[model samples]
Every structure is written in C-alpha cells, then in structure tokens.
Target: MNMPDPVAVFRTEAAELFEQIESGLLDLTHRLNDKDQIDAVFRGLHTLKGSGAMFGFDALAAFTHHCETAFDRVRKGEKPATSELVAAVLAAQDHMRALVDRPTDDHGDIGEVLLARLRCAVEGDAQQPASVQPNPAVVVAEAPKSGSNTWRIRFSLPVNSMVNGTNPLGLLDELRDLGECKVLVNTSAVPSLDVLVPTDLHLSWDVTLTTDQPRSAIDDVFIFVLDDMQLDVETVTEVPVAEPVAAVSAPVPSTVAAPIPPVTMAVQAPVAAAATTERETAVSNADNRQAKAAENVRVPAERLDELMDRVGELVIAQSRLRQLASASMDIQLRSVSEEIERLSGELRDTMMVLRMVPVGSLFGRFRRLVHDLARETGKVIELVTEGETTEVDKTVIERLADPLVHLVRNSIDHGLETPEERRAAGKDEAGKVLLSARQAGGEVIITIKDDGRGINRDRVRAKAESSGLIQPGAVLSDQDLLQLIFAPGFSTAAQVTNLSGRGVGMDVVKKTVEALRGAIDVTSQTGEGSEVSLRIPLTLAIIDGLLVRVGTGRYVIPLSAVEECLELSLEEDLRSRGRSFISLRDSLVPFLRLRDLFRTGTKPDMHQKVVVISTGTERVGMVVDQIIGDHQTVIKSMSKLHHDVATFSGATILGDGSVALILDVAHLVAAGQQQEAQVRAAG
Candidate 1:
C-alpha cells in the first residue's frame, strides 16, 4: 500500500480553489454589491492561504495573503467591491496558481507588482485611511478586547489528518491568535508502539480561550478541516475564577504553541470532564458534517483511468470465454459464460457512469475566459451557455477543452463584430456568443455560436486560391468551401493579432476532433453570424454496436446510429445496382455498398442486409452480407499508418478473436450526401 504524496494532493486542491476564487470574482464583476459573492471569494482565498502554509507552499501562502486582505477589507465594508478590485484579484489568483505549481522557482518580484495593483484597487483614488491600511501581521494577531467572551473548544481530527498535510500545531496557533488561550493534548486513543502507524494522528485537543471575535471566527480557523473533524465549542457563560491548579498542570504539547502564560484556566478541566457535557447541537452538527464528507470520495483521476482499463480487459476476457463456451456443448459451461457476460456488461455500464461528468464543469471555466477576452478586445461581448447539465465521458471532456477554447476564441475574434461596428450595422451594441451542448445519437454535439458579422465567403475563397489549397474558380459546394477554413495554414484575418491568425488554431481544432473519432460542422449566413458544431463520441472506451459482415470483413456500426435493418433481396439489389438508391416510405435514400468500398474482391451474399445509420439529419444505408447480433465493443484506436482511414472510426476484438472495424457514421453520411448532390446535378 502506497500513500498519496501530500504535496500533489494539495496542488490539486489549490487548483480547485483557484477555480472557485476565479468564479466568484467573475460573478462579483457583475454585482459588486453582492455580499454573498464577496464573502465566497474571501473564504476561498483564506482557505487557499491557510492550506498553502500547511503544505509548505510559502510563496503561495505569502502571495495569497495579500489578496485575502483585499477581500477582507471589502467584507468589513471598509472598501467597496469595484471592477478594478475584481480584476486585480483575478490577476493575483493567476499568480497564486503559478506559485502553488512552482513554489521553489524564482517568481522574481511578480508578487510585489500584483500587490501594488491590489492596494491601488482597494484604496482607489482616495487617500488610504489608517484603519483600512493596517499591517497584515497586526490584522491577524490582534489582541482580544478587555471584556471578551470565554469559550471552551475541543477537537479531534481524523486519524490520517497528519498524513494529508494538516498541521495540527498550525491550527492551534491560529486559536492562540484569537487571544489568551490554553491547549492540552488528549493521548488516550494512542495505540501500542507495536501496532501504531507512525504517520497517523491519535491525539485530540482541549482548549479554553478568551476572545472578542465572534463564533464565526472560530469556525474560520477550522473551515478547511471542518468536514472530516469533530469539533465542539460552547460559550463559558459562567466560569469560576479559580477551580483547580491541575488544569494548568501540563505544558502545551507542540513547539509552535505560544509562550503566553495560561490565564483564568478554569474554563474546563479535562477531556473526560468535557465529554460528559454533550451539547446536542454541536454533536449533531459534527455528525452532519461527517456524513456530508462521506458522500463523496476524492479519488485521483489517474486511478479512475486505471480502473477503466482493468474493466476493459475484463470485458475482453469475458468475450473470449463466451466464444469458448459457445463451441463446447457443456450446459454448465455455457451457463457460466452467459452469467459472466451479463456481469461484464453491467460492470462496463457502471464504469462508464463513473467516467461521465457533467459538461457544466467544462463550461464554468469559460466565464473567466470571456471576461478576460472582453477586456482585451474592448468588445462588449455577452457569453451565453445552455444545456450545461448534459454529460459526456470525462476523457472526452478533457480532450475537448483545448479545441473548445480555440473555437470560442475564433468565434469572438473572427465572427463577432466590435460594438461600434455592430451599432453601425443596425445591431445591438453587445455581441452574443452562445455555447451549448446536447446529445445526438451516440455523439455529444457542442456548438459555439456567435451573433455578429458572418464569415465572408469571398475572402475565404480568395485566400484558398492564393494558398493553392484550391484552384482558382474551382466549382465547390458551400459546405466544401466552408471547410477550407480548417485547412492547414488557412486564415482569413487581414492582420495577425495575439489571439489568432498566425494561421494556427483552426487546423489543429479539426485534426484534434478527427483524432477523437469526431466530426466538425460549420454553418454561416452572410449577415447572421456563424455556428461551429463539434460532434464527438460520448465515450472513447466502449460502446454497444451492431455487428455485421460486409464481404469477408466484419464491421461494427454503433447501435445508437442504427435506425433499422432491412433485408435486400437479390432482385431488389440488382434493380438498384447502378444508382444505389433505396426507396422507403416515399423517400429515396442513398446506400453505400461496403463490400465494393473495401475492395474485398468477393461476391456478396444472395440476400444482403442494409443497415441504415444516421448522423444528425443525414441517413445512409450500409449493405452487408450478414447481420450479426449486438456485441459489446471495446474501442481500440487504429495504428498511425491506418489512422487516416475515414471509413472506420476504430476497431474492436470479436468473441472469436478477430478484429471488427467500427464504422464512422458521420463520414459515411457525408459521403452519401455528396453522392446525392452529384446525382441531382447530373439530372
């Protein structure tokens, strides 16, 4: 058994905290007076600073402390939240991320620069007031007032708390900062040396403190560990001035404990005595927090990937066993194989569900991107997102993030008009960029749409001709012409800018989508803006497929795309031989003969089957010699040499240990549509 590196765990946590802080700041930009958003941002920063210090990320903690102070001012109503303040904190948050990632590297005065910006944002143009400009150390270590409430505090962290980069001494030090405090360790739970785990913490603490700060201040001290720790706090409304000298018998346990002499130490005597005074409210709250903590386990993503691979291998083994059972005539062996097959199928389904994450997590990061882009381009851009709850495979989501970023940037830079340009064109001053996701068949279609000046077809054609991508005056369909934008080194920008047009991103977007066994669709009107849709498979791992034999070769068509299968008699097949057209219920659908496409050089079976598959609005028929039953398809990527083969998306192993190609429905449907276009032109 290996333990996770606490540093790595803290880094992951810091990344999530950065996201939360960034999100709250972005929200605050719109509603500066929204106290909820203000408090959320402050808490996120506070947690980040405290956790950074715990994990030995000194630079991160130091840099974040300044940002936290800025927010603290806002929370205290000493300063109002302004756009400048939000922007300043947003920039500081990025620096904090870098510090968390590379704590040892020389960050080189960047912290000072950002802190200056923060101060300016906080103080604005007015002279800084004395109270609002207090020193950071003083702010943290302020003494308790003359007449402060007394409270008894007790807590015991989880056994693995120390292993998870929590410094119990640091938490105790924070309590001391509140005011005069006394802390005692309870070592009753310690195991024998032979059975003890060195890394585990078995000690608890009992503390009596006198502080003017409210109870919320105490809560803040334990906020990061509150979910998994048992904490009890009760106000000492009546405390005897002197109860027993034994209460102060033991010195504070840790070296980090303050040297301040214990004062009025008769709040509570010992852990045993405190246990008898069970405050139902505090205990019930602790139980509720612990219950909430147990609801979700934070497993590392790589672990999930490893589990998925194991499941995939198990599925393959089950398939092989089923084949063996089918050959042997033993009833018990056959029954066992059937049982394993059912179990493997269910396991695959469950693994897939674990890997499926809501697309909203992917969408949430774009809010900061749009905010930054709006400021950079001086464009009044409004970003709208829909269908965020639609789910897709986590792997697919991870891979699609870069492609989506490029698409959104291109939409804003190329498709959207500036506010001045929009107003002159009789449109609203603000341009709208819409991002949405929805499931279609087996694919998740993510669409990036913008309402601005549409693509200039004439400009694209001129650039394509100049680059020799297409011949001058070459006749092409609108769809084909639109696709030229994705060609390598293709750009319609008149001048290069930081965001786009070194002729770089669009081509990579196309290649990446293709690599995922996905397709890209583009639509534009002359003046109504443009829309780019990326159709990617919901999962890259496994799928339910309809297996069929085309000539001597076996192929798998995704079941989600299969509408219905029809038997093609020899007479009907021969009648439609030249045109390859099939009529069904008043519509003439084009069909592709896979035997001829693969050049198998074998005659088709007398009674052929046409598997009708659809991608979006286009449907195509695939002619195969035999229709095999449904099979659980664990998708395997084709080798680099055969990766460009557009007819098949991937390959899967059959129960008989042969490879079956998975058909690319989008490509086949496009081919069918092209054939229909050519036939119509001939007429």
Candidate 2:
C-alpha cells in the first residue's frame, strides 16, 4: 500500500516526455514535410510545459514555453520544420531534462547559450519577428463592456487544491475583473477543530457577475484546478434597464430571484446553455471512464518478479514430486504429480510471455543515435530498421543495449566513409546503415550493416601484426583476419577522431556478446560493404534442454541447437577417435567425443549417440552414451569461481535432483573447428 513519491513520478514522466519530444523532432528532421511528426513534437512540448507548471516546476515551464512556441509555429505551418531547428530543439530538450532533474543547480550561461542558438535557429539573423502582436479587432470582440449579461457562478476548490499550489483567490480576483461581481464564501461542510485538516480548503464560492465576456471567460477562472473541483455557472439575466444604488445596504438573499430580460435574451437562450450542458456531460463521462480504467487492474513490477520467483520454486517442487511419485507404488500420487506437472508447465509459459517485450522499444532508441552520429560525423547517413516487432526476454534486451550502441558507433565511425569519399567511390553521398532483427529457430539475430567501404583484410592483418596481436606471416582466412578488428587495442584508422578510433568499441562488443553466450559473425565483400551479426538466445532464464548421459554423468544441450540425433556404429566411432569425422549423405562433418573431453574413464555404451549441433555454418557431432527425453530447464548461472569455465554456459537441475551442465555451443563449435584445422595441418 505504499504510495509513490509524487516528485519522483513527476521526474520520470518529464524524462519520458523529453525523450518523446526528441524522437519526434529527430523524425521531423528526416522528413521535413511530415506534419504528423511536427504536431507530435509540438504536443509533447506543450504537455511538458503544462505538466511542469502543474508540478510547480516554474523554471522548466518558462524555459520549455519558448521551444513549444517554435514547434507550435511549425505545427501551424507558419514556418517549415528544418534540420537546424530540430537540432537546436534537440539540444534544448537535453537542457530541459537537466532542469527537471536538478532545478537548483547553477546552469549559469548554458541557458543563454542555448537560447541564443534557439533564436538563431527559429528567426535566423532577423530581428525578433515583431513579437506576434495580437490583432486589435479580435481584442475588441473579446473585451467585456457595460450593459452586459449577468452570470451566477458556484464553485468549490478541491480540498487539497491549495496544498498542491492552486490559488483560489487569484481565480476569484479574475472573476471580479470580468465585470460587476459579488462573491460569497460557503463554509457549510467545514469540520470542527478535532477533525479538521487546516491546510485543506473547505470554502466554496457563489458569485454573481454581469459581463460582456463569453462563458468561456467564466470557465477559465477554474481551468487550472477544474479536473479535481466542482464548478457550475449559469447565465442569470441581461443588465437591468434601471441602475440600482452602488451598494444595496440590505441583507443578502440566499439565492438570486431575478428573471431573464428580453433585451439580450435572444443571443443567450438556447445556444450557450445547450453547449455548456453538453460539454459538462462529456467531461463527466470521460472522467468516469478514466477512473474505471485506473481501478480495474494494476500489477507492480516487483509483484510480478515475486510471482516469477514463486513459480521457479513451484517448478522445483514439482520436479521433486515427480521423482517421489515415480519411486512410490501409489497410483493416486502419480496422477496428482502428473497434473501438477502440467499446471507448472503452463504457468512457466505464461510467466515467460509476461517477461517478453517487443524489440521495437529497443529499436526506437537507435533512431536518435543514428541522427546524432550522422551529425557528429558530418556524413549523410540514413538508418533503416526492420523486424522491430520481434520480442525477446526483457533481461536480454536490457543487456544488449550497451553492445548494440558500441557496434553502431563502430559502424558509423569506422565502417562508413565521409560524404566526399562516398561520392568519389561511385556511391551515393548518403551512406546507408541497415539495422535489422528477427527471431529464427529460438535465437534472435541482430545485424548491423553499412553500405560503405568494406573491411580491408590487409589493413587488419598489418595492424594485428604491428600490435603484436598476431604472428607475422600468419596464414588465416578472410573471416579470421577481419575478426582481428575485435582484438584489444587494434585499429586500422589512420588517425584518431572523437567519434571512435581509440581501438576500444569492437573489442567490448565481442566481450559482451560472448558473455551473453552469443556468437558474432562477420561478412564482407571487397567493395560492397560489411555486415556484423549477433546471434543470441531468445531468453536467458530457461530453455528446452535435451539431457544426455556421457559416461556416468549427465549433460544437457540446448534443444534449439540440436538438429537431430543419430546412432553411431562401433566401427565408425573407433575410426573417428583421433580424427573425428562423420559421413552424412555425401558430406563430411566433424564430431567430438564427450567421454574423452571430460576424461571419463568408463567405457562408452554399446549404442553411442551422436547429437548433431550447429552454430551458423559450422556443424559438429557430440558423442554420448544415451539420449534422455526433452525437459524444461530453468537455467541457473554458475558461481563467479566457475565463470571462466567456457565449456558449459550454465547449469540446470534434473527431476532426480542431479545437476546437468548446459553445453556452450559456441565454444564446442570453435573447439571442433580447431580440431579440424589441426587434423588438416597434420595431413
């Protein structure tokens, strides 16, 4: 039942608003004719300003007002939305976030600097566009005069309204300014001393006014606190033909007993009354719907996490129940265990879906990155994204962000060439970076591609050798040499620049991908472009694992990675010990022996199983004693002490309470490739 801190909520909402504004502005920068993006940006700024003022962030409201005005002009087509304008506003949006975050901090000259930039962007070098003077004719139509209609107004400020910084007296004063006015404060609902909250306003007002101003003027009195307060206004009558004494000097009546006069009655009879009634009804319905929506449901994130933890424990308990049921003679216990197993499986599936978030949220972020990088590098770059609706575990997406950022920065800085360089190379001046993600066979493939100068294999090799990262004259394939760019302190750039070239990004990308138990693939053509792809599992929490017995111990392999399983003949198994190669169809594939790798002294079973696993284009066979049926595995991480154990990615517990190590497919594939290379060298 803990309440959220209002200030923290305000800050969080403000930050989201800023991000939305920046994103919209960035989109508008790309397609200057996109009226929707321009309007969206304007609305975001407008909302931020209003919300800031509502939350007592006067400085933020005042500062954001200027940017909102500029965008409002763009939205209205008074000025075109330009790249320079978007850039200036994007910079201003950052400052707005700082102000929202720490209003008391000394911003000093930063505001002046940004404001100057904003003015230059909006107005160019011209004098301040004449300050948008209001038309005198419209003012004459709006101003109130004598011989106007009288309105009876009744309103009560929200009990906590004053505490929230809404000034009711200011509203009363505004009403007095409308025309001839009389105000009375009602204290009928005021509580006694023991029960009263002194800070909570208990006073309501009844006012009678004669004004030429429209009913909108009366509504404007309570506009700031209208959402939480009660207000009612009705036109009483037109101004009386005969003037009354200045002060009646008589006892005030409880209600006005005046009748409507015919002189100004025709203009106010049906139209104004009907419009006001309709608006109130609509507002009431909207408020009710909003309240109902808020009341129906809400599950806190911590609660969901707690439920997931309980589900994990329930899964463990179910595993124990199944083991105990199998060992017992009672048929009823076995049936109950079977039912529990089914329920637990369904619960796990539901929990996983709850944890899944669409990758589009993550993808939207790179649009801003691409925009900034294009500006910083002074290169015309268009970022194209696809398969954004693909969903992955939230945990995986969270960890993937840093690596993705580094990869993208590397692509912009090193993979893409300058505009002049691109034009000279017979390519379009605007370089293209395509970022795509899609789910394939239980893995998410994220690719960062650039249509710029391809990776120079010779340069990578030269750099690797000069840095002592590789032996001189080392014979390697194109893929192997290109991968040297991921080596620590390796760079081929001729000069270091602010964007990149300290030789840090790619290596970090490599390390992060490896830590996620993911694999990175690189492909390039001499003059076409370069593409770097990361293949990561759909979820890190659990997997459908195929358990197999190797000698006496059990091991689990990701069911996603297993293409198929086959029985290996005793003769073929013995012949492939030193050089493990298997013939399937007409192709030869490499295989590994788990018994030998684990140094299990026991002899292999009569019928050995070869589990065919593949990582990208590399296929490998793992020999085991027996194949166990597929089981749902809740993956548990190894202790920090075993973090360096590359052979197994994780560990999971079996229904029989035994721990089975989950094989690392990438490491095993690499080991198989190394074994194949050694055998070829010997031959």
Candidate 3:
C-alpha cells in the first residue's frame, strides 16, 4: 500500500476548496439575498484558511484569511453580500489557488491589485455609515461567567501533527495559562523504536484544569487542527476546597463519572439560576459544531481512477472466460461462466455509476462566464439552465468544458445583440441564453439556445462562394449551408472582434466533437434565434454493438443506430448491382455493399443481409453476408495513422479472437444522404 504525499494531497484539496468557493461566490453574485449561499461561501473560505494553515501553507492561509474575514462579516449580516464583494473574492480565490499550487513562486503585482479591490469592496469609497453601537445591557448578557471550574480534557493530535509544524506544547502552555493544570502524556500505544516513525505523533493527552475562561477559549486553541484531530472536553465540578489543589491528589466523586449534566451544573450555579439551563443548551451547541466539523472526508481522486481501471480489467477477463466456456462442451463450465457473466455485468454497472457525475458541476462554471461576458460585451444577458442533474461519464465532462466555453462565448459575442438593438427589435432588453442537457438513446444532448439575431444564411452562402468553399450558384440545403460555419477560416460576422469571429472557435468545436465520436447540429431562423446542440455518447469506454460479417471480416455497428435487419432476395440482389437500394416497409433505403466498398475480391454469398441503420432523418442499409448477435464491445481507438479514416470510428476485439472495426454511424449516414441525392438528381 503506497502512502499519498502529504504535500500533494494538500494541493489537491486546496484546489477543490478554491473551486467550491468560486462557485459559491458566483452564485451569490446573482442572488445576494440568498443567505444559504452566503453562508456556504463563508464556510468554504473559513475551511480553506484553516486547512491551509494545518498543511503548513502559511502564505495561502494568510491570503485566505482576509477573504474569509470579509465573508464572515457578510455571513453575520455586519456587511451585506454584494456583487462587487463577490467579484473581489472571486479574483482573490484565483490568486489563492496560485499560492497553493506554487507557494514559492513570486505572485508579483497580482496580489497587490486584488488586495486593493478587496479593500475597496470592504470599505466603500463613500464615508462609512455611523457605527451602530450595541446596548450595554446586551453586552452584559453575552459576557462570559466569572468563576473557576474543573475541566477534563482529552485530545489526540493529528497523526501528522508534528510534520505539519504544529507544536503540542503550545496547546499545553495555553492550558497552563488558564489556571492550575495537570497534563498527562498517554503513550500506551506507542510502538517500539524499530517500528516507530519519528515524524508521526503516537501520543495523546489527558489534562485536568481549573479555569475561569469560557469553553470557547479552549476550542480556539485547537481550531487550526480541528478537522484532522480528535478532541473531547467536559466541565467537571469546581473543587470543594477553596484553594486550587493538584488534580491527581483530588478525591474522585461518583457524580463526575459521567461528564455531561454535572459539567452543566458547575458552570451555571455561580451565575444566575436561570443561566444554568442556558449553559446546558450552549454545551449542546458546542457538540453540534464539533459534529459538523468532523463530517468532511477527503479521498484522493486517483484512488477512484484505480478502482475504475481494475473494473475494466475484470470486464475484459470476464469476456475471455465467457468465450472459453462457450467454445468448450463442458456443461459445468458453461454454468460457471453464466454466473460470472451476471456478476461481471453487475460490476460494470456499478463502475459506470461511480464514473458518472451530475452535469450540475459543468453548469455552474458558465455562471462566471456569463458574468464576465456581460461586462465585456456591455450587454444585459441572463443565463437559464435546466436538466442539470443529468449524469454523464467523468471523462466526457472533462473534455466538454473547452467546447462549451467557446459556444457560450460565441453566443454572447456574435449571436446575442446589444441591449439597445434587442429593444429596437421588439425583444426583451436582456438577452436570454438557455443551456440544457438531457439523456436520449445512449447519448447526452446538450443544447445552447440564444434568443437573438439568428445566423444569416444568405451571408453564409455568399461567404462560402467568395472563399471558393462552394460553387457560386450551387444548390444546397439551409442546413448544409449552416454547417459551412464549421469550416476553417469561415466566419459570417461582419466584423471581427476580440471575443470571436476570426473563424476560429466553431471549427475547433466541430473538430473536438468529432474527436469524441460525437455529432453536432445547428438550427436557426432569421430574426428568431439560433440553437447549437451536441450529441455525445453517454460513455466512451464500452457500447452495445451489433456484430456483422463483411467478406469474412467482422464489423460492429452501434446497436443504438440499428433499426432492423433484412435478407436480400436473389433477384433483388442481382438487379441492384450498380445502385443498392432495399425496400423496407414501403420505404426505399439506400444500402452500401461492404465487400465492394472494401475492394475485397471475393464472391458474394447467395443470400446477403442488409442492416438498416438511421441517424436522425437519414437512413442507410449496410450490405453484409451474416448478422451476428449483439456484442459487448470495448472500444479501442484506431492508430494515429488511421485516425482520419471515416469508414470506422473505432475497433473492438471479438470473442472468437478476431478484430472488428466499429462502423462510424454518422459518416455512413452522410454517405447514404449523398447516395439518395445522386439517385434523385439522375431521375
């Protein structure tokens, strides 16, 4: 078992904390009055500062301290949480991430600039409003009781306390300052010298003290290491004897055996009689705080990835076992194989669930994008999101970020109009961008819709013709023309701007989607709006594929794309040599002959099979010799040299020890569309 590097763990944790803080701040910017979001942001910052300090990130701790203090004020209602304040903190959060990532690197003037903004946010440029002084009576009511009480303290420093620069002596010294104190080091579990690690603390402590300070003071002593350590404290009765005596020598009372109600009695008896009940309630409050502080658990991301890898290997092993069992004649072997198959299927399902994460995380990022783009473009834009709870594989989510950012930028910069323009067009001044995600037929469809000036098809056609991307008077569908926007160096924008338009982003989006084995579709109407949608596979690791034999070589078609399989009659096959079209349910579906397409010099089977497949409105039939059953395909990418081959998306290994190329559904569908157009043109 390899141990994680503590420093690396700290860096990872700090990065996640910064992201959570940034997300909360961005959300609060939209709804300033949302107390829950304000408190959440405050807690995130508070935890980050404490955790940084615990991990010996002093610079990060100190930097986060200022932001935490500001948020604390907001949480307490001493200062109102405002957009300007959230923006300032968001900027500071980025700097804090830099500090966590490279503590030794010089931040230069970035820190100074952010600090100035924070100060301005904290202290508005105008004169400060008169400070409302609290009533003296209320202050008295909140003051701590003045009396000595015995405290039984039990605590264990975190396992890595010493290495993290924490000194247990400091806590002991603070306890000693409270009054008479007896500290006993418990080393009963300390290992032998040969087995012991010097850097790891193996000692805990039991301390008995008499103090006049409130219990909160003791908690403050361990606040920095609270999350990583175990601590228990209970107030005991004050010694009956007047003078402070040695705790070891003091007589034990049965009343102190159980440390709860008696501790409540000791603190409140000396104060007003009614204060005893309040002190009991305060003890419970302290327990609640400790419970919440202990609830957080951190696990390394690599551990999850390792588990996924093991699951994948298990799936492959199971596939091999199933293949061997089916080939053998032993009934018992087949039975065991069946059992293993069921278990492996269940394991694969579990692994997939583990890999899936809610798309809400991806949705949260766009809030900040919209905020900044609104400011930069000087347009009032409101972003609406739906179906955020849709779950997709983590790998898919990771790759989708950049393309989504580009789409959003294009929507704001090019698709959406300025507030003045929107109003003049009889639309709402604030433009609306709706981003949504939903699962449909093994694919996650993410749509980005904006109500603004739609794409100009005439301008696109004109641009394509001028650039020689298309013939000057060539006939084309509106959808085809719109797709030309994805071509390199093609832009319909009248003027290029910093945000987008030198024809760069959309092409990248197209390439990226294709690289992920996904497809993109665009729809727009003049003066209405534009919607761009991406259909990406739910998971890239595996798929349910239909295996077919093409000229003794096997090929797998995505099961999601297959509609039906039909046997070609002898006369129909002989007649359709030049043009292959199958009649299925009174509809003429064009077919591709795999043997001819692959240039295989083999004679066709007497009865060939036509597999009908469709993607959206386009349908095609693939001619093959045999229709094999459904297969659980573990998709492996093609070699870089063969990456540009449009005929196959990926390759998979069959149970019979043969390689099968997974047909590219989108590409074949496009080919079918071309075939249909040519046949019509000939007619």
Those runs of model 3 whose alpha carbons end farther than 4 Å from true positions after fitting are 127-317, 576-579
Q: Per-residue lDDT tens digits of candidate 3, residues 338-440? A: 9988998888788788778788889888988898788778999999999999999888898899999989998888788998999899999999999999998
Q: State the weakest 10-residue window (summed lDDT) of model 2.
A: 135-144
TM-score to true structure, per model: 0.84, 0.82, 0.80
Q: Give the runs in model 2 whose Cα sits over 4 Å from its true position.
A: 53-58, 76-80, 102-105, 128-303
The lDDT of each candidate is: 0.84, 0.80, 0.79
Tens digits of lDDT, candidate 2, 1-683: 79777677788778778778878887777699998888678768866876777677878877886787677566656567778888988888888988998988998777667767776676655553367533321211222233466677889877888777576766776677567788888989899989999799999999887676667556645543566778777766554435453333232354756664665568676757875775575477558857886985544567777777788778878988988998999999999999999999999999988888888888888888888888887999989889999998888898889888988888888778898998888999888999899998878999999998888888888888899988999888677787888888788889988767788888888888888889999998866889999999998876888989998999989989999899997887887778799887898778899999999999888899899999888899999999977878878889999989999999988877888999999899989888888888898
By TM-score rank, best first, the candidates go 1, 2, 3
Best by lDDT: 1
Error of 1 at 499 (Å): 1.2
Question: lDDT per residue, candidate 1, 1-683, as tens digits?
Answer: 99878889888878888888998998888899999999889889988988888988877876777787678768877688999999988998888888887888898878777777777787777675687774533332232233555577999999999877788988997788666688779999999999999999999999988666656667778876776789888655422335443343343343444433354244334522544433343456567857887997899898999998899889989999988998999999999999998998899999999999999999998999999999999999888999999999999998888988998899889988888899899999889999999998788999999998889999999999999999999989998999999999999998899889888799889988988888888999977899999989899999989989977788899998899999999899999977888997799889999988899999889999999988777788988999988888999888999976888899998877889989988889999888888887887
lDDT of 1: 0.84
